[model samples]
Target chain A: MTVFTLINISLLAILVATALTVSRLRALYEAAMLSALFSLVTACLFVLLDAVDVAFTEAAVGVGISTVLLLGGLALTRSREAVTPRRRRLPGAAVAILAGGTLVYASQDLPAFGSADSPVQRHPLTDTYLHQSQEDIGIPNTVTSVLASYRGLDTLGELLVVFTAGVAVLALLGPLAHPVDARRRDDLDLVDYRVLRVISAMLMPFILLFALYVLFHGDFGPGGGFQAGVIFAAGFVLYGLVFGLDKAQQVVPRVVLWALIPFGLLLYLGVGVVNMLLGGSFLDYDTLSSDPAAGQHLGILLVESAIGITVAAVMTTVFFSFANRRATR
Target chain B: MIGTHYVYWLLFALMMIGLYVVISHGNLLKKLIGLTLFQVGVFLFFISIGKVDGGSAPIVSDDVETYSHPLPQVLILTAIVVGVATLAVGLGLAVRIFETYGTVEEEDVLERDTTP
Candidate 1:
């Protein structure tokens, strides 16, 4: 076998090893850590594919933020608990098998691996962005153009979904600051949580800075509202993790969340309302202004900011629920 | 022959094992492991779909100008992040469940919780 082929095989083998390790891990904490490593490897594979934006999201969401949240959540519960397997496993099995079969069938019809000229690579949409994006959108990254301008409506739905998730979390929790049993409340040594405190103190600024950079730098690269929004929320999540939920909640008060919910929702809706009021149809930015490009940029910016606010607010709310489930109000 | 496609076969096998773990394992943490393995199966499938034999790195270099489409790789990366986030949320929920119930098994936790 060629050296390249050997390396690919090795990579695949490592992936299998990681999967096995996850299954065999007796400790919950170690399993989470190993899974985090697996995520890192998956992200590395993305980098090799030239998918830079996806790589960034994977790194931030998977290895960096999610792992922290899981570990923190684990701290609130049992560290290691043995639980036996249960019966009634057939329905899920059948579905998974059916799904697997369909997936295998789908793979059969796909073009052979690494075909130089696939339909997707040679599509008109690609050539349109590659050739004309500079003069039209004036963006460096084609992904931005597609996600922000071409497929903006879909992104709006995603933002709305995030906001809805926040509301759902709040609804599920019932009321804010309702008391649960004292024993259920985690009793990790708050005073001794020196590592978390120190790390948050160090990371909080860089996280926010990076979020902002991603927010604005999106037009020039593989970023925009969704990625930036998620990252910004991740920063607050970090704070919640380190400083304890109460302290983190203090920084981002309930009033802010209450206000932001409507504000973000209104901001996104208002843009569409404005568009309807103008000469164009709903969300049709031609009515936004005389210069279409200017209108597109404005629409993208306002919508993106709204998305960021809603995402940050909703994620904080979700984490808040996890911290204190008695939020009835 | 398609029958000799080791990568595809491996992917399906891992997928089955993951599904089995998720269904049979009573522990909350085990469910997460199963969920991850399942996700890894998807990731592998996507990567394999994007694989080009003799396909050099997607990065633009002086010597070689041609490269495979980098879009799928990018999508997979984002998918990885989303997968991790879901896992984190899942684990966090498991932790909270454990704290309240003092057990990580789904059946045990369900037995204690009232409908009210």
Candidate 2:
């Protein structure tokens, strides 16, 4: 048997087991944990598929950060449901038939399992990045080049989405309405998490460093602003969990955070304006420098920085809003 | 030896199981887990479709070199991040629901929904 055949069998077994466990498991917490395990396995599959950057993200966000957040949310609430399933098996059967038919229809046109030549490989966009990117952008990693350079504008919008969500959380949640005033308490106290506080404190610097490395390293890899920003904010969140939200606020500063929203937004707009002044289209970095390649790199770097700032600030602000509600109440 | 079609069958089976749990189960966390399972099953399906039976790993090692479908993997990575973000937001909503309802059970939470 081939290696893929063997791998497929194991994967099939795992997916089945995880599904059954999720269905049979009664407790919400157990189910969430099981789901996280599934995500981790799926991430491993991604790595095996040569998607290492994605694998790192899936493991970090899906298995680690998101799971912890879900559990923490669960802790504030009760565990498990009181009701059992009463739905019949036929609706599912009918749905399955429909979905199956749809899948078959779609698969008919799809290239057989990994036909060496497919639209994905031959697509103009990927072709440009794969062949033209090295000379045009001076980046080793085509994915990063595409994400930060070719699609810089899209990344800017994504940053805005994150920033807006952060603001919406704080504005609607009402707990962090006046973060500055409430950040003055005995912020040194770690509450029930003194040990955790110490660990997170030790880890925070490294986490931030990793974020920077990812940001600067994107020229050759999948590390970029959006991912780096999320990771950086996550590190701060770990700190908040350990040292308490109030303490986190003091260090981050309500002024700095609230200001960062506009700052990140303006920084992005500024890049666009710079492009306009330099005689390129809005956000076109090639105009900023005499050499288009240098301009592209600088543009990507600046746009990436903007993305990182917004993601970090937004995620931290949103989490603070969640934890601060009861504390302030 | 099993044929390649059987591999597709297994993928279909896994997908069905996950979808069933998600739609049939009433437990909130169970639903989330099922949703995640359902999503991952789909990813597996796509990744499986991207695999070449005799092709080597996509990595460009000195000893052996081959090309494989790398796009799907990257797309799946994005999906995974989107999945986690959705889960975080969903859990946040669940927390809010619990705070107002004092329970995580679907039926109980629903009944108490109007109470708040």
Candidate 3:
């Protein structure tokens, strides 16, 4: 077996082990941490599969943001899962086994792993996306080209879905309860950690800067707005964890977040509308400049920035909503 | 050969474990974690399908002869973001449920609802 295949199998085994452990754990906090480990392993597997962009995103969102969100949810609620009678386990196991059996049966017809002759690899559009994109979009990263241009409408929808989820969470949780006085000794914020405070304070600017670099460097590498936005939110989240949510809010207040929640979606829509006005189909960037490739580049940058804005704002808002809630026993 | 399709089998097993957790677990947070596992399993399946032998990442490079399919990566990319968004919403609901019913266990919440 090749080294890559060996690595792939090993990672998949780790993922399975983590998933099983997560399922068996009754401690919600431990389960959440294991889930983070699961995401970390999954990101590694994605890299092995030659999906660096997806791997980058999975690491940022799944490992970083999702873990923190899970922990925050755990803090707001109970940490231990309640025990129940085991009599009902039969049905769940039966259903899972039956469904899994069906999948295994169906898998007999699937293309072998890493086979070059798979239908997906053989499809005409694959060639177009991999080759034609260079001439048409003039971008080095085909994933970015397809995401920001060819499937721009789908991404716009995805952005809307994210925005809607943010709005829904905000409505459900309500706004952050008024920030308690910073000087008050409270368990909510880590006011006593001198080292964490100093270190995080030193790291905050670089974190934000790295996020911006990821956003702009996507055309040439393995990141884009989604990953960058999550990284950005994670930076603020780190700041909040150490310094306190109130300080984080002082930097990016609630009003600004509310405005930003829809601004990115609106900006994306406005770009499309402008494109229509310029005598091109909606979201066709060719009309944005005399040179089509340059226009495509400009349009992608704007839309990616718009995506970054909405995602960063929504993620921070969601984190704040969860963090600011008063824990009720 | 088993070697050719072992990944699929393993992924299906992982997905089934997630399914079992979602169904059998009473804790809302546990269910969400299960849901995440299930989603990630699916993501891996999609990404694995897009892989080509001896291919590199989809970033265009003259040195690389083959590139893994970018379409699936793009689809799963958005799906990951949406998955997290859904998770946030689910967690929010769990918190609200805990506030109203005083527990995140499904059976307890149902018992309380019926008793009231």
Candidate 4:
């Protein structure tokens, strides 16, 4: 067997084992950790498949922030899952089996794995994005070009969805505030372990710095705004977990997060508006500057920065809401 | 020759396992885990489909002659972010459900609903 096949087999085995373990485990904490493991393995798989950007985001958001957020949610609720009765399980299993079977059957018609001559590779859109984009966008990263410029509207819609989710959480959980419970203050301080405190304090600055790197590096590499934003929030999340929630809040206060949430979305929308005023289509960056390539560069940078800001604020907002609920409860 | 499709088959199995967990488990948290598994499995499947026989990473470099399609990678990249956002919202709702009903089990919450 080739080395690639060996790596794939091992990673798949690990993924399967982790999934099964997570499914059977009743303890919420263990399950959450296992899910994080699942994400890490998936990220590795993405790397093997030559999708470095997806791998980076998956590692940062899926493995890192999402796991932390799950734990935060668990803090407000029970850690152990109630036992599901055996008889009630069949229907769901049957449906899943049926769906899996159908998908596999459909896959029979697909071209073999990793064929360079596959229909997807021969598609005109792929050819255009691969070759024309370099000259048009003047960015090394074709994915960013396609994402931020070619499919600008879809990205706008995605940003709005994330914004809406943030708004919904704020509505549901109310504002971020300190824990009302005197007992909770003591509970929060438990994370004030001297070792964790000192280590995290040392790490938070570097993490934030790395986040900035990811945000700006999108033009040339796998790093981008979404991954950077999550990393930024994750730094604060680590701070919150280590110190007390109140201390973390003092650092990033609820008011600032709230304001920043909409500010980022508006910034993105503003870019489009400017384009319209400049005699171009909405989000068409060509009119933004004298040189079309330069315009594309500037538009992508602004839009990506906007994405970073909104995503960071929203994720931090959701975490605070969850933590706030737990404390107040 | 057909055995080469093992990767896809394995991914399908994982997806089914995730689906089964979401469907069969009564606990809300377990259900969320299942949903996540299902989603990740789909991600793997997409990435697998995009792989070329000997293509390098899609990043533009003069050294590489063949590259996998960048479009699917971009699509999946956005989907990953959306997936996490959706998971956050779902978890928030789950927390609220626990707060109101004092349990994260679906059956327990259903039994407590006596508005009729």
TM-score of each: 0.78, 0.82, 0.97, 0.96
Q: What order do you get sorting by DockQ, best first?
A: 3, 4, 2, 1
| Higher-lDDT candidate of 2 and 4 | 4
Ranking of candidates on lDDT, top first: 3, 4, 2, 1
Candidate 3 structure quality by residue, lDDT tens digits, B5-115:
999999999999999999988899999999999999999999989999899999998898999999999999999998999999999999999989889999989999899
Pull out the clashing pairs in model 2. none
Q: Candidate 2 on B1-116: residue-level lDDT in tens?
A: 13535555666666776777666665566567667777777877766665554554343334644444445554554455556555555655666666666655676666765676
Q: What is the lDDT of residue A80 in candidate 2?
A: 63
TM-score for chain A, prediction 1: 0.82
Clashing pairs in 1: A114-B52, A174-A327, A174-A328, A175-A327, A175-A328, A175-A329, A176-A327, A176-A328
DockQ-derived CAPRI band for the predicted complex in model 3: high
Clashing residue pairs in candidate 4 (N, C-alpha, C atoms within 3 angstroms): A114-B53
The lDDT, on a scale of 0 to 1, for candidate 3 is 0.91
lDDT of 2: 0.66
Candidate 4: Cα lDDT at B11: 94
Tens digits of per-residue lDDT, candidate 1, A49-75, equal: 445666667666666566665665665
Q: Write the per-residue lDDT of candidate 2 for residues A172-274, one digit (tens) a residue.
A: 5435445453433343346767677677778889998998998898776667766787788788877777777767887898678877867877898899998
Better of 1 and 3 by lDDT: 3
Tens-place lDDT per residue, model 4, A136-201, is 998988888888899888888888988998888777665432234212355656474899888888
CA lDDT, every model vs. true structure: 0.64, 0.66, 0.91, 0.86
Once fitted onto the true fold, the runs of candidate 1 whose alpha carbons sit more than 4 angstroms away are A1-8, A76-106, A174-203, A325-329, B1-14, B43-102, B109-116
Regions of candidate 2 where Cα sits further than 4 Å from its true position: A88-97, A171-199, A327-329, B1-18, B41-79, B103-116
